[model samples]
Target: MNLTPESKVLIQGFCEFISGTHVAQMQAYGTNLVAGVNPGCGGQELHGLPVFDLVEEVIEQFGVIDTTIICVDPYDVLDAALEAIASHISQIIIITAGVPPLDMVQLLRKAEACETLVIGPNSPGIIVPGKILLGTQPSEFYTPGVVGIVSRSSTLTYEVAYELTKAGLGQSISVSIGSDAIVGSSFLQWLQILDEDETTEAIVLVGQPGGGSEEAAARYIAEAIDKPVIAYIAGRQAPPGKSWRQTGTLATVIGRDPNFGTAQSKLAALKEAEVPVAERPSQIPELLRKEIKIN
Candidate 1:
């Protein structure tokens, strides 16, 4: 949600091997990580931060935590997230990969009912370049600036940010909405946030071939977003099954579903919406610059 330098953060299922460096890096980057949640490890210290047995304990001791970064075992992600939501943490970022889709479905229902914002089951989370890091986004690629970047591909998110930074276009915020098939957030959700954000001047949407998300984003941008927007859809040349890693998208490989989740359709939708589409990550800066100038 409204992440800032002062946002108090906690980690769910905190593990030294999985989350140690990230914790240290977040602290170094100025993120206000107040505590962590790892059952049976309560009262223990890792990375010089307090670890709690439960999300409620962390809340009771630290007061309101703004975000919780979940890095538990794949199967444990659901319980970890439910605990965070129950604790009333506004933002939940799930970093564990390979979470069963059913678990995500359940988490989404609870999150929506509680008005909670979940980032990913397989995500890099959100970063406010030079301000705070909520997940494991590499800090080397980002800088403080006006553009807001949102992507389904974590690797592409980094490459795009590096390109933007290289072109002297730093980012106001960068969000990896998770590469999983059933993520908590969507392109339209973050698009609306960026459009209304005072610090964000433009938006870069990095999409993949699978799913109708890119097409949905195009429709939303056409009607709702006032700020300039540019897009780069990966997997244009990727064969059906190889296009995306998500299970649902992988089905396209066998079904050859031409009407859905095709890169051609995504590009057509974005083009029809008048959104500039970059052929490559390096071209994003140039297209974004053109969009900003025109708007």
Candidate 2:
């Protein structure tokens, strides 16, 4: 779970207000802002960071970028993603803004062909505590520790990490894999990394009502992982035909066989498989304490 320092991150859509805020937040977290791309804001300064009109110009000046954070509108997301893949400047690319699923499907196809690790077209980005902060989350809420957290909801990820810190349990890694249906990566992918991380003693998975991803992970945990897992599946009893906050939740509800009963059934599957499922958010800390002996 150690985050090695890399050269710089090339950020997309520097002209937006939220993008500017995200840059400042990352700077506070100690990440060097190397370059930015905005088609209209070329040659201007954004919060003291140089802005370029295009990705090519930014890459030409900055050399290789370790990461790229996309903060543009959904309409522009696919083009930005293609540019990121073509540039080959970063090992990781994070898309913080929400994009259409149809666009994401095309983006994912390109990403797989390019072999690039894309995180979120609708996410909070990844935080490798004490090393780099590449998303919209507050830096003060994170610390370097031995627990790895992976969640679908950005807000819930923040709350879970906050609670862990309050209980004196810091985190080694915290990832919000976005709430979008066709977004990059999955809970299992992050869980694989955490399972092998020597610094991680336990895992905290925050899932919402939707998808069998949690159930799949629970089966993995039951068979493969030895470390304790503490889970909280949100919106279990959410009424049918209503969408929850997470986009993935809504998609899972809409596209499944029974059409909308997947969430509660997924929770039941996890519990049946012996995964410690918290019925409520408040029960998470206490359950985790008992399972991991963190007291």
Best by TM-score: 1
lDDT of 2 by residue, 1-295 (tens): 2245565787887434255677788887887778778888899987668989887787788786777778777788888878878888444445545577788888888877877777776778888789888778777888888788999888889888888887778888888888776678878878888898887888999987665677778888888888888888877667865666556543433355674335777677678878888776667778887887664
Expressed as tens digits, the lDDT of each residue in 136-204 for candidate 1 is 999989999999999998889999999999999989999999877788989999999999999999999
Q: What is the TM-score of each candidate against the true structure?
A: 0.94, 0.89
Predicted candidate 1: what Cα RMSD to the true structure? 2.2
Local distance difference test, candidate 2: 0.76
lDDT of each: 0.86, 0.76
lDDT of 1: 0.86
Q: Model 1: residues >4 Å from true position, as ranges?
A: 15-17, 246-257
Output the number of the lDDT-best candidate. Answer: 1
